[model samples]
Target: MGVVEADEADRPVSSIVLIEPANRADLPAIVSILARETLLGVRDSADPGAFPDYERAFEEIVADPRTTLYVARLEGQVVGTFQLIFFRALLRHGALLAHAEAVQVDPEVRGHGVGRAMMDFAIAEARRRGAGSLQLASNKQRLDAHRFYERAGFEKRLDGFKIDLSGH
Candidate 1:
């Protein structure tokens, strides 16, 4: 909501971070951030040749009314991103569920409250959307991410599993 100030010892800087729905033009930066900042970079790429595929995927995601891809901008530069999906769940008496994925913040801005602000934005957005809960899964090997999520008030109540359909 306000400009986040980095610790003086870490980096004496402050800037307003705004999280909003991403546009087509933001895809390149978004892809670059994902590839450069996350462990999933092995599967994600920022190559110029990869733009076509990313563009197609972005089109489909934006077409869906229940889904939104968001970007966090710091001083007008793309610095972070996350995707949020809203769905109805039968388990919680037909409650609306918000699933957040692909959250990443540039390494250059780590520990500057960018991630925290992005997460806080996600939580607020979920609530504003009338979601009963906001849920996300972090890679088991991402211990730092786990700690960050915990600090954000998320609980480790269940284990998560996935099967790679790509069959790589």
Candidate 2:
């Protein structure tokens, strides 16, 4: 039930308004946004309902204690989505870290500050949860996204690696 209300009075156009936790009905829209991404498109299902595994994954995400999937609504349209996962660590003074993943903004509303708003909410949420740090990983090819994350006050300090078995 976490939500962030947007101030449309300060903007030229009032497209984005409410940001809330994504529910089952939002799966199609979320998948659509993911499908539009150049890097994730190959991994996300083309037809939103074609993947039953996604439904299972959603169910698992729901059962998890430290995970949240959020979608941004722009005038009743689901235009953006991101997932936040909190991690418990024995290091760093046993601090809990909030990790954001699979963030996507619809192409039709890319420049309307929707992505910025989502990141702001994520940071706020991490603060609310008392997480020691917030972090995320974006593909090296997504230079534009890297710039965006930087603008959101994220520093590229540590290097991350991943072994892709899916060949995406």
lDDT of each: 0.85, 0.83
Across residues 32-95, which tens digit of lDDT does each residue of candidate 1 receive?
Answer: 9887864654787888998899999999999999999998888899899999999998987999
Estimate the TM-score for candidate 2: 0.89
What is the Å distance of residue 127 in model 1 from its true position?
Answer: 0.7
TM-scores for every predicted model:
0.90, 0.89
Please list all clashing residue pairs in model 2, or write none if there are none.
Answer: none
Model 2 residue runs over 4 Å out of place are: 1-13, 39-41
lDDT tens digits by residue: candidate 2, 26-53? 9888887887787644666658367687
lDDT for predicted candidate 2 compared with the true structure:
0.83
